[model samples]
Structure formats: structure tokens, C-alpha cells
Target: MEAYLAWVAIDLVIPNPMNPRRDHSIESEQMQEILRSKGWAEAITCYRKGQYYIILSGHRRWHAAKKMNEKEVPVYIVQAPENNAEELDRLGSIQGGQVDWTPYEWAKYTYDIWKNSGKASYSQLANKLGISQSLVGSRIRVYKFYPRIEIEDKLSNGMYSLSMLDYILKWIKRVEKHHFELYQSMGEELIRKQMLKKYENRCFNSKIAIDNIFVTSACSKDILEFLTDINKKLQDCQFELELLKVDNEVDVTQNKLNVKMIIDEIRLIECRTKNEAGNLKEELNKLLKEIELKENQLFDMVEN
Candidate 1:
């Protein structure tokens, strides 16, 4: 495509209406600092449209410039592509080299293109994008199954990764194909949502860990039920914690009775033999350690 470099007025440069990125938050602190100290390391990629240039890439840089109140920014203007497919290909190619798009974003836009292009075949669309047909199919499936905005939001928070989603999708398909009855019982959409929620809450780092845990059983009913049970238990635990916070003096009478019992036991131990005292001290130390560990766990649960 024909291209040229120019210094464009910031006001005249507009964000692409079709840009897959929805979160237009300012650049990171580190990136902003870089802009302050060393301005314009790379030019904004754009194309002219009527009175304004639509950004194809470097959107974050444009945002940083606007936040800094810079009047003008460097831009690399390119010739607009002839068709929608070419434009999308150009957009993907340019953005792929910069800040990564989430899988949901990729899938959404890919689906959009596919739909607008008269519902093109996966192989035909893959040929245009120069990716495998299987990948195109999977992405379309992901787009079809997941709520785009919610998944995008969670993914932006860094708790989830595309690789995890990839494996989760595979697991879902395997369940649908191999364990058809269970899939119908739970529904594919619910399965996807629950798996994603459980994976995030548990803070699992490896997709394989989740896959192996869920798919190991020939009968996945038990495993799926166990996941649902864990979710309920976690909700109940959180609810209990909130209830405890409502009553500061909850179980005070019982606590006092337990303390008195402990004190009486200690007094009896004080009057016992030296060897007995040493053994009691050892047991108390171990018990104290165990209590400390349990207390820490409770604190974590409350905080969560």
C-alpha cells in the first residue's frame, strides 16, 4: 500500500470506528513517562478519511499525546485498502505487531468480517488472513459461545489468559462430543462461564492443570458437580464472613468458656511433674502453630 509520514494535528486524527479495542484508557505510567522524557519513538499509523485521519494503530500513543496536551503528533499515513477484507487484514497486521489484542477481540472482529462478507467459509476466510482454518473455526466458536464484553473486561484485568480460554474451549468441545448427556444437562454456555469463573477464582497458572482435573474422568458428571459444589461453598463462606462482620461480639459466651477451660488446664499442668510439663509445652507449641496457620487462612478468606 502507498504510505507517507506526516505531522498530523491531534484533533484531526480520529480513532477507527471499527477498531476492535474498546478500552481507550490512557497509556501505562511507564509509557507516559517515556513520552514525557523521549517523545514519539514511533509514529501513529493512520489513513486519511475526508477531513480527518482514522487511526489504524498506535492508539495508545495518540491517547498519551492527548493526555499530555500535545498539539501535534507524528503519523504514518497509509493508502486505504480497496475492500473490507483488505482493510481488516491491514488492521490486524499492523495491530498484531503492537499491543496484543485479546482473543475475544480477535474472535469478535473475525466473526464480524466473516458475517459481513456473506458468511464466508472458514477456509476462505483463513486464506485471506493467512491463518489455519482450524484456528479460524475455533475463534468463531469462541465468539459464538462467550459474552464478548464481559470476557474482554475479565481478560483485561490480567487474571485470565487466551491460552486458558483455548484449553477451556477444547474441554467444552470434548465434553459435548464425548459426554453429550452432561453437556445438554449443563448447557455449553453455562459450562464455559463456570469453567472460566472457577479457573480465575482458583488463580490457576497452567491451562493443563485445569484440563487434566476436569477431563480425566470417563464420567464427567462427578467432576462438574464438584466444581458447582465448590462454587456454592465459596459463596457460603463469603456470606458467613459478612455475617460475622455484622456482629463484633459473635459467640462471645462460648469464646469466654473456651478461654476459661484453657486457663484451668494450664493451671493443672503447672502443678504437674517437670517431664509432664515439657511434654505439655511441646504439644501446646504444636497446637499454637496449627491455630496460627488456621487463623491466617481465615484472614485470607475474609480478605478475598
Candidate 2:
């Protein structure tokens, strides 16, 4: 079949069942807003199939059009893919840059392709998909482990994250190793559920905070060192900013002095003249105490 563009009735185009995307509510609503304001600009990509056309991409746009009671919409009709794998590849390639696939969504399509292609090698599949083999393996693992609809929905909805999944896997390994007694007592399924619940409740709104808390819970010394490095860099930036305010020429001559030597001199002067050093010391002390408390509490939670 020859590929061509045409205007089709809104109802004639159907969403692909094999498309990895499960949730379109958010994207569709955003597109609906765009349509109302600027009107439709991009054509839906689809392929001829029987009396109706199956969408290859632009499922969200089609949804948005229907929601707004659009009568007809522009569509680019392409030749039907020879196989499911080809169709999935086309969809992934087309949508790759526009929007990221959710962790589970990516897993779903990757698993489907692997399965449908007679269980192809991870290396071959990864090469074809332009991703690492380890990534392909991990996605397949995620798909298998979280096959339950409810769990997949939570991951798709962004209630949890891909990093959280990695954390959960690490926690499981630790439970199986150092915490063997707890693992035996709780069993695998319950341990998984409990960990999910624990992280879900503790998950923060910000990625940085989530990483901080997770890292702190796992190893406080690392997070403390990370914070210390960040603080030192912040102080350096502040010093540079102050110098820029006083005279731009200070920047030109900054390389002449050892930056560390300059910072130490400034710190010594500030320590002599200001109470800010005392406050920072107190804050660091408080943070240390809080971290110790959290470590103890986390250990207790894991054991109980």
C-alpha cells in the first residue's frame, strides 16, 4: 500500500491496541487545550486497516480531537507494517524525542517485541532499539516483576519512579543477604508489598529530596559527604559573586592566587568577624544528630 495523507472522519481512526502507551488522559487534555487555542496543526499518523485506519502515532491528538467533537482530522496514512515488531519500532522511533516513555510503558513494548520476535537475544534487540543490552534486560525484568495492573498503573501515573524501582531491587537483595531472618519471616511477596508501601508513603515530591532521603537511609556518610561538597561549591560561588560586585578585575586575577588559599583566608576572616560560622557549625551538628536518629529508626523499621 502506498503512503499518503488524507482527511478522515474522527471515528474512522482507531488507537493501536499494541501501542505501549496506556495512559493518554494527561497528554490528551493538554492537546485539547492547544486545539482550542491554536487549532489543529499536526496530522495524525496512521495506516490503512480494513474499513478503518489504525493509528501509528498521534493517539493523543486523535483523543483530543474527539473530546472537542471534531468532525474530521488530517491524517498521514502509511503502508501497514509487515509485523508487530516493525510497528512498535516505528512508534518508538517516531515518538522518542517528543515525549519520554514511562518506565513500565517502555518495558511493556520492549518485552512485547522480544516475545513476538521469537524471544530474540537482548544484544540484538538492544542494538535494534538503540539502547544498551543491560537496559533491555532491566526493562524486561521490570515488566515481569510488575505485571500486575495496579502496580503498573502506579508506575505509569508517576506515583513512583524508575529510581525507586532500582532502590527496591537493591533493598530486596539486602533483605535476602544480611537480613535473611527477616526475609524468611516476611516471605518474598509480603516483603515486596511492604517495601512498596514504605517507599510510596515516604516518596517526596522533588527528585533531589527523594535521592537525599533514600541515600541517607541507605548510607548517611555518603549523603553527608555529598552535602559537604555541595556546601563548599556554594561557598566558592558566593565568594566569586561578592568579588564580582566589588570589582570585575578580581576575576581576571583570580587564577594568580591559589583558589583554596583565597577561600581559607576569607573563611578565617569571616570566622573572626561573624556569628554565621557559629550558626553553620550548630546546623551541621543538628544535621548529624538527625541523620543518626533516622538511621536508627530505619533499622528498627526494617527489622520489625
Q: Once model 1 is optimally superposed onto the true structure by TM-score, how far is the C-alpha of residue 8 displaced, in angstroms?
A: 3.3
For each candidate, give its TM-score against the true structure: 0.57, 0.58
As for candidate 1, its clashing pairs are: none
| Candidate 2 whole-model C-alpha lDDT, 0 to 1 | 0.70
Q: Per-residue lDDT tens digits of candidate 1, residues 229-299?
A: 53543334334445655564667667778879977987776636888878888999997998799799979
Candidate 1 worst ten-residue window by lDDT: 230-239
Give the per-residue lDDT digits (tens) of candidate 2, residues 1-304: 7878899998898998998887666567778999889876778889888979898888888888888899999999988889988888788887766756777888888899899888899999999889999788878866776545646768767787755565565546554665465567657776566556656655322333233223323233332232234223323333445555567566636744765675576466545545877886886689679769978997998999
Task: List the candidate 2 regions with Cα displacement exceeding 4 Å.
Answer: 148-159, 170-187, 200-304
Reference-based lDDT, each prediction: 0.74, 0.70
List the lowest-lDDT window of 10 residues for candidate 2: 204-213
Candidate 2 — which pairs collide? Answer: none
Candidate that scores best on lDDT: 1
